[model samples]
Target: MRTHKYRTTDVAVDGGTLHAGVWEPVETIEGAEVPTALLIHGITASHLAWPFVVAQLPDHRVIAPDLRGRGGSHAVAGRSSMRAHAADMQALLDACGAESAAVVGHSMGAFVAVVLADTAPDRVTRLVLVDGGLPFDVPAMPDLEPEEVVNAILGPTAERLSKRFADVEEYLAFWRAHPAFQESWSREVEQYFAYDLVPVGSSLRPATSLETTIEDMLDLNTGSTLTDALARVAGPHAVRDAGQPSVLFYTVPRGLQNEVPGLYPPGYVEGLLAQHPVLEHHRFEELNHYSVVMTERGAAVLGGPLREAITERPAAVG
Candidate 1:
């Protein structure tokens, strides 16, 4: 029942403006030292994706941004890469005057958070990756073209980018019919869906750029920056990199459809965590990928762990 109040603003970045959602708590915490966390949304998503999560974390300041070439910045022109996205995060923090913040990313955003934490460690205090990171279990097929690779993994998301809807309402209807959000509809959901629409000629289409999305998809799979970031986070080259850090990674048992296995295939997360031994993970059997922030229950679960990640001390060196 927390009605989080927030303001929408745009900040100058490398290519174009990044539309951001800045949420402030209704009540002040005991200490004036406010902890800030940056929430990054998934592919084909916008800053609006974190409204429910913001509502739950009333004590913390949440900064969610519409990654370039999505939502309000749909026309943002730039080469999309995980490294570029991570740098934008640093610039965003500077613009917002936050010296450091916990970086949390959902889905593709998780990969960006990992890159940010590794590439710009001074600006990132912690990392919370929701439903992403550690890499998706994409098969290694040398014969498949990059486009083919993207289409195979992205599924409906890749197709939806180009499919134009008759109107905003029609686009919202499409989302309503989606298996992920079909059972979890609300005003907030509708608002988020509404923000996804953009006028294309006479028709309407999703605000995200299909090409940018595909490029990012490719980066998530084979980008060198991403691989390097993961290595550094796991203590590869740093001297005091003792294979530990304040990282929280959460995953839902079900996929976007609430039927498939999940974004992180079985054994993928466990093996990666075993190697890194720093990422604190929480798995939810009932929550789907989209509902992790879209639904109340999902937000509640995320809010609790997210609060601890931001305010609590890192686990004692073991």
Candidate 2:
């Protein structure tokens, strides 16, 4: 087994102080001068979600922060949203002394990367989004009440607020059996769930709340959040113009749990991808949403296409 060493730090950002995990490359690859990258986890996840990727990018310094209300840093002063999360990332980057670094985000973290690139373009040299880019295409989730949304965020493994499991083995078993994780099982997959919770009383609970999840889902300008951000990445655009420059989008052929089985329509991602002229889309034949981020193979499949895109960053344009 490969042991990964990381440091934990807390820093104040837009709304509150956040917990972050930092890992320096154990080995260096020739010609890869860049020493840093930020790993942003998806909704209901924390810094632990990026271990496989962090291990792969041994040449780059990696910083993984548990967004404001998830993972090790669950407490926050106020509600959480994409904008707030983006600002938190900026604070993390600044604290790490990273002037410019490549950023990789999965799921909701992918959306946060878009907002970060849009709001603080100078901080990011390149951006890689895994299974996230466009806004929620399922329309307002009126039928899904606030409590229902919260339940999903906690999952079945969570025990209470701000605390998770200390027993890594037990937690791993719970995660392996989860319907969302059924398709993804690997060492990285086990680690992904192991890091998401902190022990509380006799059980474990997620660091983030359903309220936080609901706020992000409803308040994050779902309509134009991604469309606008992608356009900025592509370059200058008129107020009325839509679409981004040099953006690469990757999607799984089958939607994740809520997206297709529980939430979005099958045609939603296809329709969204069509709007962006510069996006490079790759389709995975069998993987679902969670598996794409939870397993090593999932990350490899994503990293291959994304690496190609970064190497071919769009030419400088007026």
Candidate 3:
């Protein structure tokens, strides 16, 4: 069973139509304004990635949109920079009449959320960054190429997409075989897969264009304007991560596990928390990157620590 019902549509933003999905509260509490939440997914993922979180955020209207070129908003094209994605988020908020809302983001979406908060602090009432933000504190090796960082790990899956499969089932067979899906996938994740692909010329291709993927990698690493954007935010904030199945950086296969004692690096969220004294950090010791946002544990991660972080803010001075 789902936590809340959702609506889907095309929203005009930044000169093009972007696909957006929204889930709102079925019931409102007394004297509460019915908060709104804007969820931004990571690279290559769409609004579908948020079902688990949306279920728990039932009291607040939850909104998740395919940032520019992913999912149902495939026809749109852009440079795939985080700034552009942030701008699209702003427009989405405007269209929904949410002058300000709680912003929740995962992976690359976290990068955008930081940028949005930085760029338009007035427009964001609160922020929750999941498994991202605060750069990985690792040294760059001389031999490492940029592609090694972006495509190498998922290279097999990307290449296999070109092959013709009998149907979605066959494709899913190949997809499930990938190491990324080894642990387990839920029904929502399966539905996410269904919505992520579109049939083109008898072959099912992921809705995101290759250009969008490539350009995002380019923008995030070298031209990433987010670090500066995150610096400007001074408001209610929270950062959370699953402590197990570590997410990190290194040169070897399964390097994340071998790299360090922590999932990220020392001071990973420390710097941001230091800057914003109000920022709260919650680390779930048993979950991993994906499950941190997809499972029941994820709901608790948001509801217990994160929800308190946002709602417990001190009253503003007159």
Top lDDT: which candidate number?
1
Considering every candidate listed, which one attains the maximal TM-score? 1
Between prediction 1 and prediction 2, the one with superior lDDT is 1
**Stretches of candidate 1 above 4 Å error?**
1-3, 29-31, 235-245, 314-318
TM-score of each: 0.93, 0.78, 0.80
Residues 1-318, model 2: lDDT tens digits: 343458888998766688999987655657766556788888788887777666566556789999987876777668787778888888888898887667777778888988888888777766776777565544445567665544443344233333455577766776666676776677666666666666568876665766677687654444576566667664335122232235556667445442343222347655655655455556665666666656677667666665555444433211
> What TM-score, to 2 decimals, does candidate 3 have?
0.80
Cα lDDT tens digits for candidate 3, 1-318? 556777987788764799899887777778878777888887778998887777776677888999988887777765778888988998888888888777777767887887887777667766777766545444543365655545553355345434565567876776566444556466777788778788787778777766677677666666438656654443333222332111111111122122233335435556545664444566555455566675555566656655554454422110
Clashing pairs in 3: none
| lDDT tens per residue, model 1, 171-287 | 888888998888899998899888899887999888886788878977877747777777777533432444345467789888867766887755887776776666677887788
lDDT of model 3 at position 311: 51
Model 1: residue 250 alpha-carbon error in angstroms: 0.8
Model 3 lDDT, full chain set: 0.65
Clashes of 1: 0
